[model samples]
Target: MPAFPRHVSRKNEYRILSAMLLLLHLAVWWDFGSSKSRSLLLAHAGVFLIWQPFWRLEKRFGLKDTVLFSLVSIGLACWIFFCWFVVLIGLMSGFPGYRRSGRLVYMPILFFLVSDLLIGCVPHIFHVKALPPAVTTMFQYGLLAVPAWVFIVRPHPGGGASLYSVDLLRAISASMMTGMLAVASIAITYHLGVDYPVALFQSLLGLALFLFIISWLLSPRMGFIGLAQLWERSLMNIGTPFEQWLAELAKLADQQQSPEQFFEVSFN
Candidate 1:
C-alpha cells in the first residue's frame, strides 16, 4: 500500500473535523429539551460559528496581524462573557436578597438574552441599512412599554407596592431604547454588505454594547435607589451647601443683635 501525501492527510483531517461539528450540531438540536439549555447552546454556537469568523476577516485577506490580534479579541470576549455569566448566576441565586428581589434582578438579563437572540437572527431576514431605524424605534418603544406592562399587568411576587415610579420607569425605557439604537447603528456601519454570518455577529456586538450602556445607566436608579435617594433622605440634605452656610450666618447675626439697641437693618 502507498503512503498518503502530507497534503492529502491534512485534507482528510479537516473533512473529519467538519463532519464531527455537523454531527454535534444535529445532536444538540435533536435532544433539545429545555429552552434555557437550547438558548445557551445557541448563544455558544453564535459566538463560535458566527462571531469568531467576523473577527478573523482581516486575517482572511492578510491585511492585518492575525495571531496576536485574534488572541486579544478572544481574550476580551471571554472576559466579558465570564463577567456577565457571574452576574447572571448571582442574580439567579439571590446574592443580596432572596425571593422577589432575586427575580427582579434576573428579569433584565433574561430579557436581554432573549432580545439578543431575536436580533441576532434578524440579519438573515433584513439588510443592514434597513435594520437600524426599525431596530431603534422598536427598542425605544419596546423598552418603554414592556416594563410598564410587566409592572402593571404582571407585578412582582410581593405586590404592586414595589413597582417603579413613573420617572424611573421612563428613564429605564429611554436608556434601553437608546442602547438598541446604538447597536443597530454600529451594525449598519460596520457590516454594510457582509455575508449573513459576519453581519449577524456585527449586529450582535452592536446590540450588546447598546444593552450594556443602557443597563449601566439605569440599574442604579431602578434597583439600587440609594444614590437617587441620597439627597432626599433629610430636609437638610435637600438644599445646596452654600445655602445652608448662609442660613447659619444669618442665624448668628440675629443672635448677636442687642435687645436695648434700635439699630436699623437695611433690606436689599
Candidate 2:
C-alpha cells in the first residue's frame, strides 16, 4: 500500500480533484477559443497542475521548467477541445504506474476517460449539432454526481502515488485503446450509413456489449477459473513438476508394507 508523500494517509483526493476540474472545464469550454475562454481554461489547468502527476509540487522549479509548464498548460487551454482535454488529463492518471495504482484510482480514471470520449467526443467527430443549452448544462455540471456516488465514500489510508513514475507504454495504451473503441464504433456505424444521433446510440450499445463480454471473460461469475486468474496461474504455477512429484509419491507407497504403514509414512 504505497502512499503519496504529500498525504501519508492519502485518500486519492488529487485524482478525483483533477478529474472534477477537468470535467468542469469541459462542461463549459467545449470548443477552441481565445481571450476570456482561454484564460478560464488556464485557470483550470493551474488547479490540475498543483496535483499533476508528471512532476512533484513539493520540489522547486527552475526558469526552464516553469516556462515549459506554462507553454503546455496555456497552449492546451488556448486551443482547447473538450474531448482532447479530458483524454489527455485522463491519460496522465496512468503516470503512477498501473501495477502500483489501486482500483480506486484506476477505475475512476478509466471511467472519466471513456465517458468523455463517448458522451462528449464521438458525435462531434461527425459534425453533429450540439445538445440544447439546458440539457448540456445539466449534463456538464451534474452528470458526474451519479458515478461519484459509486466511488470514494470514505478516505481510505492508501492508494495514491508514492512517487511519480510514468509508465509511458501504459499511459499511451490506455488512452489509445479507449479512444480507438469510440472511433471504431463510430466508424463502423458511419460506414453502415447510420445517421448522427442514432449512430451515437447504436455505437454506444455495441461498445457496451463488447465491454460486458470482456469483463465476463476476465472474471466470470460461473463456477470456473477466470481468464485473468488462469493467466496469472500459468505464469506462477507451471504444472510440469507435478508429474515428477506424483511419480515419487507412488514410489514411496511401494516402499511401505501395508496400506496403513504407507499412509503413515507418506503422511509423515
Evaluate model 2: give its TM-score: 0.54
lDDT of 2 by residue, 1-268 (tens): 1223555224555545555556444544466354554565566665555555555545566788778877876566322454555456446555554453355555655665555545555455455544456755665666465346424444334544445466665667666656666666667665876654466566667768987877777775754465777656655664547656777789988897799987887778
* Backbone clash pairs in model 1 (N, Cα, C under 3 Å; residues 3+ apart or in different chains), count: 0
Off by over 4 Å in 2: 1-34, 73-113, 121-126, 131-135, 144-154, 158-174, 185-193, 212-268
* Per-candidate clashes, comma-separated: 0, 0
Q: Write the per-residue lDDT of candidate 1 for residues 1-268, one digit (tens) a residue.
A: 1223333222332233233233323323233324443444444443333212123222242325445545544444322332333332233233223346435533553454334323432322243333365764574345443333333333234322212222333334444543454345545556574544455456567667876765665566567565445534443455667678777667656865663332333221
TM-scores for all candidates? 0.24, 0.54
Q: Which residue pairs clash within candidate 1?
A: none
Off by over 4 Å in 1: 1-117, 120-158, 161-163, 166-191, 203-268
Go through the candidates in order and give the C-alpha RMSD of each one to the true structure: 24.7, 12.5
The C-alpha local distance difference test score for the whole of candidate 1 amounts to 0.40
* Model 1: per-residue Cα lDDT at residue 240: 64
Give the winner by lDDT: 2
